[model samples]
Target: MLDATLKAQLKAYLVHVRQPVELVASLDDDAKSNDTWELLNEIAELHPDVSAVRADDDQRRPSFLIRRVGTEVGVRFAGIPLGHEFTSLVLALLQVGGHPPKLSEEVLTAIRELPGDYSFETYFSLTCQNCPDLVQALNTMSVINPRIRHISIEGGLFREEIEARQIMSVPAVYLNGEPFAQGRMDVEQILAKLDTGAEARAAEKIAAKEPFDVLVVGGGPAGAAAAIYAARKGIHTGVVTERFGGQVLDTMAIENFISVQHTEGPKLVAQLEAHVAEYGVDVMALQRAQALVPSRSPGGLHELYLASGATLKARTVILSTGARWRSLGVPGEDAYRNKGVTYCPHCDGPLFKGKRVAVIGGGNSGVEAAIDLAGIVAHVTLLEFGDQLRADAVLQRKLRSLPNVTVLLNAQTTEVEGDGNKVTGLTYKDRTTGVVHSMGLEGVFVQIGLIPNTDWLRDTVALSTCGEIEVDQHGRTSVAGIFAAGDATTTPFKQIVIAMGEGSKASLAAFDHLIRLPAAGEAVAA
Candidate 1:
């Protein structure tokens, strides 16, 4: 169960319990059930306000329900909720024990005001970094509204259910016994899906916002840094993004962040968000920018349109809309997405444990994914369309040393093979021989490089051949009163640290531009 240090930590956390909480188990006599009991027993013994009892009502063995003493505010775990889900379990206990959920007033009110029953079942893997947030959101909602119920099921522990439901990805969610969602999500995203008018309401709210001095159009490291720096300069700052973290949320290990020895993407994003919040930066999350309209006159407001038809105005705009994982456009790739084809190896690799899989591409990401998957899966076949690996020498050396990994250079993925359900294998072509081949496997991880999210700006901004926003050393774009940074720009490197530095530089440059401009509605030159 829990070690000494873990038990001590659990005890300290249990002190926040204000009401009697029960850990009702619906377990069998299996080894996993015994382990669950040990965990539950250790937790129950820590505080007087907590207790464990048997209730063999659920069909899922080794399951347990966390409920308040006198109310139906409860959540369930269908398996051992350790690893990434450990935080979800702790938060569930605190919330069910009468502690308020750590969400905004608007989100809390929305969850409590939901109209109908919502039995959310989130299928998760222990190693997935993206599953915890989604699971925790549902769990918190269940506690906030008794009509909502969330059951977090570990995909690794329940092989039958994973197969029966054809779940090939972690954090796969089901609402009221039907497919609901997949991938990383927060409370706001959940609400947007459940409430039909949530989008309209959010659009209206965003449209009512006043113009800002510096309005950043992303929420990755670059956008966060730009927003913080602008706000610190005593200028009105705002960040409008599709999501707060961007591709960073899908990332796992982040070892090269300078001062920080080691950290994960989600953890770093959380800290970045907190830092931005401290500066009182107006953050408009879950909003996608559709177009950018530059001001016709000096010091006039610049308009940024959203996909929801909501528009925001600002003095200067910083485009840091980062990049997304590039997918193999081969046939069946889209049809079997999350059904055996996945982009994130760190998040979905565990689902293919002990099974054969293929890693596409010859770049650093592809090689790294192959290396990481070698330790988890039975065998890994690395396919590269180039003649040689483009990863660093050190990475290539480590990848070559893996016994379970097979590297195939000059191989191009042609198509993904599936049985109208899950991915079965893939077809590839040999670059030199002009011969086609196929391999039977359970999963396919596409590690192709990222594509910058600058499609909407292609018509507005000066774009490079690859569609990256073209910018100078000072982060100034071709358009007046506009700047760009991060992966979306023509930056030499696509690292997080570089993006942040570029963002800060862009903010300073924007500030300089603002100070030299003429009064609003006055005639001036760029």
Candidate 2:
């Protein structure tokens, strides 16, 4: 069944249409034999304009295309509408129905006058929900203009294509057959790229530039630390980041970071930036590193290309891209995000102080959140989907000692209960008994795990099976000149203190490499 919220949004698209909307469910052979066919027939009969067409017969195939006419929207399920082909369906619908929200005159004019056709093909896995918004934003632009086309290929189904393209991560976008951008991009950036045509030319020019003494790939805590240290050593260093703060900006507060008893994530990031800036480190914000090209030089100088077509050469690179929160894929979880659903206990726990809350997961993060919340909240229900808590023995004992913490083992969160604005409770199923239960709570803290932001680096550096960048003790990657730190790297802990320490270490190593390099004018003496 279609979600009520999605259905309502779809209805909003039909305001200008005079003809009745038709929702056609295209069924396969299996669906025809099962009760799915009956359900489709029921829906078709209820709506006079709607039809359920079975693709079982050749004659019915024409009806599939016929129903698309005057239809403002179409939805696909089960079948793989991926790769270069998915763009066709979306374009057809947009052409037939027209844009519902409509674009501003300036945006529309800019899109129409876009000089050339630039197709961005992004390969993504279903696990990353964040990929969709990026793809959708691109598609929305594509809908408004004929020059730009966006394609999203599912990595799972199109394994061969993804492998051929050397895709290492979800939400990797390629522009005009070349790797153009990665990660999430805002609408304005997309428009600027489409309008300027400078990024494409810059990529070619950057390939010919000299490498830098040190290149920091992210501007987060780890990267900023590395940049400051490297710059202080008088090494020609540059920091390129999609955003200045990286994941630290997403955080609410930092209580565990040493020296600073308590600080917000953004505030901490600002301090790091200030420190780096004081050292005269070259910082590039709102820019993403497109690729890392290794130099033939023995001393480890490498070329770092940016999405905007700019390039920086460096003797050593420090990647402190950091990690993203792992989400619970259960229903209604997204609907209550920021309202009553939160990922960071340090960020949102205080809000639920003196109120009942549920912490989900069996790992160390889950146990830690529960133990911490026990001190502040009225009661904490620790729901572990595993047989037992996977935290360390000492932490498990501490959790058990807490009077207000209740541990529920082998419990899986099936759905998040919400009251439109905030979370009200949660529904879960017992793995052992097959019994389902619901509990009321003021908030839900998800502590499942963290996914390293190394997807974009797969083509440039080595990554572990767990998606972490593989690095040596000194924060050097398998590939020379490229270093990694923080949670994104193959470090033991995901703590801020550890990340900062690793950043410092990587910076020192980078500085050492820079000092050994030939001086600017003396290099040609050889």
Candidate of highest lDDT: 1
Model 1 per-residue lDDT tens digits across residues 126-242: 889999999999998888888998899988889889989988898999999999999999999999999989999999999999999999999999999999999999999999999
Q: Top model by TM-score, which number?
A: 1
Reference-based TM-score, model 1: 0.98
TM-score of 2: 0.52
Q: For each candidate in the order shown, give its overall lDDT on alpha carbons.
A: 0.92, 0.68
* Candidate 2 C-alpha lDDT tens digits along 1-526: 3345534543444343433434344444553334445544544454344455656543221123213345323332222332222333333344334434344586566666777776667655543433554666666666566456665555554556655764434456788889777655655567756556545554465556555678888888788888888888786778878777777765645798888898866567758878888988777666777777877766645777677767787767888988878889999888877557777665345456577999998798889889877887899999998897899999999999999989999999999998776788999999999999999997899999888877777887889999999888888888766788888988898888898889999999877666666776555334
